[model samples]
Target: MAEKYRVGIIGRTDRGNYGHGLDSVWREIDRAQVIAVADDDERGRWSARSRTGAERAYSDYREMLEQEQLDIVAVAPRWMNEHKDMMLAAAEHGCHIYTEKPFCRDLTEADEIVAACEMRHLKLAIAHQTRWTPTLDVVKREISKGLIGRVLEIRGRGKEDARRGGGEDLWVLGSHVLDLMRVFGGDPQTCYATVLENGEPVTGSHVREGNEGIGPLAGDAINAMYTLPEGATGYFGSHRGTAGDPSRFGIQVFGSEGVVEFLTGHLAPCHVLRDSSWSPGRSRKEWVPISSNGVGKPETLPRTGLHGGNVLAVNDLIDCIGNPEQQPKCSMYDARWTVEMIAGVFESHRTGGPVTLPLKQRENPLTLL
Candidate 1:
């Protein structure tokens, strides 16, 4: 049996957890023991220790790193504030990483974080579990098989209640959407975004709706769009617009031959699809039947409870650590691109202009004035 990787969780409860679900993903990943947990909040520390059956809990993450000799550290809550430092600390401690999305609020910090991990020769995996989704994997493979003809426009959204998909919609919710876009469209060429934080009626009201269990976000709603390398196009819409209504959330993908409607509610279901043959008048357009293998090739993804997505990412991290040749599915470079895409959204909204990718002015979007 491969030696179990001993892991730790650093980050407190009442600050930046964002209900991210990392606490559970860590528990479900196999052979990876939770040895320690660190949280400034007394309640959070106790809660984490209770969940993982860890013997030690610390008020400071660095102290846990110094004492535990941990093999992996999950920087869960509010990772943005300490992204650079936590990564460096994990590398110095010789541990692998499984961090939250919107890797960091700052695009500039991306290079530094990537460099630190590379210098230490440590395996780093961002918390982009969507890469391991059974459906996603299948769809990607099918696209490669030329079933879709040629990839064209992709449209996706995360309109679940704020509990599922709000708060810094781009950073918290947009990470998954943008990752999916990259999967379908490849790297983006240019990005120009304009968000309406206020919904149709509440233009200036800060009552963003989607986040139900998580907490309130500063903004109301968020929307961003992208342009692809081969003239392909994509769009993303996220908002807390409807607090009382049922969650309306999912991805709608379009290709030359067909379309895919994959929604995450009810455990992320694959819905309707229409091929090139379909028309408005016809009851049955050339239906491109979506099969499990066709979604990307049917396969059972790891189910580690609600946070089942993390199991593959965690396992991959362990594998990467053991094998020098293993490259992560959500690599540091990928994380950087995701950040740039997100930053571009903020830039566009702030400047009222389209901020292209390889953004000429790369700066920290979340830095406080």
Candidate 2:
């Protein structure tokens, strides 16, 4: 029989409610038991304990970590301000971590968390649930088989909704597509970006505190372009107070012979076009939707929605932990690089040219503004 892994959950209900069901989702994952929970707020702590069926709860996460003897801890807070400290605490206790995305406030924080987890030889999985989508594997396999020919370029977008657009949308939504781009074209070599406010270039005054502790942010509209390793171009854009008819928010891979488009969020569908000209309207080929199992009829997904994706991510964590040779699908290295891509956009805007990869400025670029 497999050993039951003791799990603890951490949250701050005042900031984004237990990281979108991350705490309770562990109940659906096998070999994991929620034994403890912690929250700064008295009410939130009780709520988290009740939701995760934890045997005990605390008002301080550090206290919970020091007491629990947990094998795993769900650092389920959406705000980036607390991520680094919480991750460090979990690492110190030799607990594997599954945390909310946007990784951390800056690359510096990301480095510390990554190093701590590495020193402990523990698995650190970011909550980029799209990496766990089963259909993504199918899309990757198809790409490997050259169904779309030689990959040439990629385009991605954020939701560009009424409430949040531009830099905020980029950090919140663009991070997902950036990760997808990495899945397709590895890490970007350089980034050149143009950021604007009211159709004019953003100035230092434009910088302001971002939502949920993401850090200083600027730009109400942005267009960032990148050069990938193999001469492939990448584009990510978002505009404030403006949206398209269909609300384009996903990644499209353009190849020499065809194209592939993948929706942004977890478990979103993907499709392939075999037209040589890569024109959907003019080409004679049809767009075929690919799924986890087949082209049209998708296989029965294990769980539904974000909870389902969380379960898959937890499974990957467990699998990686059990198998010494296997690595977590969304490892700490991957999370740090994802933050780099986001920060590189601002660095490019500041320098008036392309900013190279493995950024020199470890802090949030917006802060420099």
* Number of the top-ranking candidate, with lDDT as the measure: 2
Per-model C-alpha lDDT, please? 0.67, 0.86
RMSD per model, one decimal: 4.5, 1.6
Candidate 1 structure quality by residue, lDDT tens digits, 222-314? 667788877788887666645334444556677777666655411255643546543525546534434445543343543343366676677
Given candidate 2, what's the lDDT at residue 9?
Answer: 91
The digit string of per-residue lDDT tens for model 2 on 1-369 reads 239899999899888568867887888887989999988898888877887899999988899998888998888888878889999999999998999887888899989998898888899888888898988888888887888888899999888887779999988888888999999888899999989988888878998888988889888898999899788999998997777767788899999888898985567768888887988788677899888885666667653778778888998998888876677898888999889999899888988898889899888777777
- lDDT for model 1, please: 0.67
How many clashes show up per model? 23, 0
Q: Model 1 segments beyond 4 Å from truth?
A: 17-19, 26-30, 160-167, 197-221, 239-248, 264-267, 277-281, 285-305, 365-369
TM-score attained by model 2: 0.96
* Model 2, CA-based lDDT: 0.86
**Positional deviation of residue 283's Cα in model 2 after best superposition, in angstroms:** 2.1
Top TM-score: which candidate number? 2
